[model samples]
Target: MDATQHDADERFRGEVREWLEQNLTGRFAELRGRGGSGREHEDFEARLEWNRHMAAAGWTCVAWPVEHGGRGLSIAQQVIFHEEYARADAPARVNHLGEELLGPTLIAHGTAEQRARFLPPIVAVEELWCQGYSEPGAGSDLAAVSTRAQRVGDEWSITGQKVWTSLAQQADWCFVIARTEASSSRHRGLSYLLVPMDQPGVEVRPILQLTATSEFNEVFFDDARTDAALIVGGEGNGFKIAMATLGFERGVSTLAQQIAFRRELDAVIDSATRNGAIDDAVIRDRLVRARMTLEVIRQHALRTLGGEQGDGASVTKLLWSNWHRSLGELAMDVNGPASLLVGEEYALDDLQALFLFSRSDTIYGGSDEIQRNIIAERVLGLPREARP
Candidate 1:
């Protein structure tokens, strides 16, 4: 906020920009713009290598405290790093679920032993993580999760299914919220356990999407086990810890995501110009709206960073998800009739994949209806939605 702080922020931004420019070269040069939302399958090994490289360079968990194997970057510095990373077209991070979501949650609520054992692997990108929150019946309504975990001696054996798990096949661990108290219901009886995924008891089945990609999976835990001490917060307090993790989900990385969206929009604009779709007043107006909406999204994201994360997270999810879904539609319209066709075996082009994948934007993370309810109840002090 002060001039000295402003100068330091500029210097940090410069350092981030220089580092990306210098490192994103040679074999890594081709990896730019690879692996994101729908395109997570692209350059899988390459991106993993890149993530490890970042970890080695102390760029992986920039916001974590220095004692926790991080650079201890301030919020502004973290934003700058992410913005520069996106501006450089760096590969989508392979350890985002670990660094951004789980790491912060651990720092906030995990035991010191948990932090010591887990934070290092995450900082080094040695272990990847996937969230185990959604289930067949409880996607947005997290309180209804039925994945059960029973404590047996020094271990907790989990048994249930989780749907819509992103990158589960690639993840080494999953932070699961299971029903620990069978007699309790809703948000009351859940326990958050960190379960390993490499064991024989755990099964990950890829869920193929309309885009012909399988980034999401159905993960089934049949007596999958974790250490009894791996539970975050405490038993029956998982709902609180899970909510904290969700708050971290809407962190500084959203700024980088917006920059990537800007790149996508630029490509769409270039395509529309090449195809002379820009001549259509309607199409051109929509493109302009897309640009303006992206700016608004960035502003809202920045503003929300300084506020209460839970309430702001709902508004942030609503704003970006709907904007992105519309951007996908706009991409299709820009391509005109050619957007309908696919290559042999239904192979999708960038715009085609973008369009199809963005269809789930409003559905995943949190749905439009769910977000509105959160905004109404939590942000506006409204009555809770009546439950059945």
Candidate 2:
């Protein structure tokens, strides 16, 4: 960055820091105290309210284009905003799919009217969205999805069952990909559509996990109708369009998520310190590794915003997810059994929740194995394997 860039970035950071110091006290303090404190559902209403509050102040999607209800801050400003928010233990994000994935895809490929209709509500957190990509047979091999979309006059009637649909029960809308023309090659016949979940013939059933958390769901769409106008890109281009959406998901958004990791890192260090374990060689070695990993995250994700997203996004996602899991385990190793308690609001107990959540990181957004394949075939010119 040049002198002017440095000065302007610092000015924005200073402003954000001051505003947070002033208006970000009570709720943030409570969240910090609560840290991984309750049932995931218990935080839903409060999280939604906080999302709208931050959106109203242009703090929710601060990196979005100025035309799309954002501050149009430089990547550095956005990083500063995220770091401060994480340090303050700001409320958890509530509009993940909408603000992170769907809005950006619409901005890039949807018509002007589509952008006008969709992006604003996402940034405002007035609309919530879930993804309908993975199906009964298509988890990692997304192109193998057999869900059908039949065009009928001005509308496309969709019929499919999507499993592992996170937050689908709570989402007001979903971005679905189905086989528009099933006869062609597997990858050639797909198309993406934005469908409303509140309409008739749409059912969302919770899939409770071993942890007893209902974060995932099974969505059945029996003749769910979405207008042709809601299509994201041209027919038969859904696979390509879905790739673009995933790029946004794993690329620029990784920066904010890395900031979340930093917060967890601090919590670990704090616990280690209070236990007088900081002086131990073992704990200090882990702290050093954590700090170095943090720097790598900033350099690789936050600073690479100007480049084409490409397969590097997948690489970064896998890297961060693995790092998160490792950090959680490290916390437990340093802090002991007290760090593994469920819904524990007390210090050291939050690490338990963090560890539990880390197991899902490799699964969501695409698995680590899938990311490695992308990096190998797409970026490294490797040969493709045939499935039996």
Candidate 3:
């Protein structure tokens, strides 16, 4: 962008910074830095309130179109807002699936009526959402989804399971991909249906992790139904719509994620210094390398946000996932032998939680193996991987 645009963005950044500083006070001040990936269980009700506060202030969904209850921020402005939010240590947002992923997908692909129905709740933070994509068998191979949805008159009955569904128990709705056509396999015959979570046919069972937290859940649908008209992008086009959602998953918010990682890295460095681990040449070198890699990741994220996608999201997913997982390992190493021990009732420290949770970074959001295949085949013009 030109200098004039850059200056305007800087002004916008200052405005965002000022607003956060002014509003993130009193009750909201206590919520700063609470409720993140492994810590989603922290101050959740308060975070929900904070999220609604943002919605009321027109702070949520800043990048969405104005007609859709968003500020219609430019890319530069959106980046500025997120950067300021991270810098201020704002509470982690609870409605990301709606505001970021599902909202954009609807705007891009939904019919006029669908957008009118869904976008308002998302913008108002009145309804929460979860992705009904990964099943026990599906995981990263999205094409392998076996969730079945059959049309019955004006409604579609969906029956299947989704594992590792983030905040499934709390969501009022879920965007589900289920097989609507029989005698079809892989990516075909799939339909993206918006199913309600409050109905009798739906169930959620929290999955406790090594960290003793259950932010992820196993969601089951037993003849759960949504209106046939609720389908986004039409039947047999679920795969394409899902891919578009994944693209938004790796959008401008990545820059804010890196800022969070930087905070974690700084804490690890402080721990290393306190425990005399910094004196070791190996640990020190690794710390320096980590810092440099983070900068490179930030630069790549900025470029990807401004330019053509062109396999950028896959590359980014690989970079940050591996970098963050390594940071968790470094935290453990810095903590020395004390890291292995647990407090009363197996209570883990922050570093321990970081280490355990980071283990799944490579596994979720399209695994490292899947990302590499995309880069190889799509970016390099290599032959596609043979499917069994």
145-256: candidate 1 lDDT, tens digit per residue:
9999998999999999999999999999999999999898999999999999999889999999998899999999999999999999999999999988999999889999
Error (Å) of candidate 1 at residue 369 is: 1.0
lDDT of 1 at 116: 94
Q: Candidate 3, residue 183: CA error in Å?
A: 0.9
Itemize residue pairs with steric clashes in candidate 2. none
- Whole-model lDDT values for every prediction: 0.92, 0.79, 0.92
Poorly placed runs, candidate 3 (over 4 Å): 306-310
How far residue 174's Cα lies from its native spot in candidate 1, in Å, is 0.3
How would you encode candidate 2's per-residue C-alpha lDDT over 275-321 as one tens digit per residue? 87788998799889988988887787865574237678887887788
Error of 2 at 382 (Å): 1.2
Superposition TM-score, candidate 1 onto the true structure: 0.98
